[model samples]
Target: MIDPEELGRALRATLAGFKVPRNIEIVDDLPRDDNGKIAKHRIRAHYADAGARTA
Candidate 1:
């Protein structure tokens, strides 16, 4: 299984060009719809709320 923590750490380590967002949440599995499609909007909302809370 892919370790989310390790994945996040690696991403943060190698992400040199882009400005990584402050609240980088490493979810085990991304939110999905009934059809198994990834719910990007929900993920965006989740991070938005998380950013708000941290702010």
Candidate 2:
């Protein structure tokens, strides 16, 4: 498994260099249905409604 702290630093570094509104969203585990397909709608809602929910 990826180290959460290391991943956070790397992600922050990468996002910091980005210039597209600087809106970065990261999630540990995506919401999925019983079949395991990602629930894009839920992810979108979460991202859209509350900015980025960081670790």
Off by over 4 Å in 1: 1-16, 19-24
Give lDDT for model 2: 0.68
Maximum-TM-score candidate: 1
Model 1: per-residue lDDT, tens digit, 1-55?
6666676678788886365554355557888999999999998897799889989
Residue 22, model 2, lDDT: 40
User: Can you give the TM-score per candidate against the true fold?
Assistant: 0.54, 0.43
Q: What stretches of model 2 exceed 4 Å from their correct place?
A: 1-21, 51-55
For model 2, state the Cα shift of residue 17 in Å.
7.7
lDDT per residue for candidate 2 within 1-55, as digits (tens), equals: 5666666677776776453344434557889978899988987797677655553
- What local lDDT score does residue 21 receive in model 2, on the 0 to 100 scale? 40
Candidate 1: pairs in clash = none
- The per-candidate count of clashes, in order, stands at 0, 0
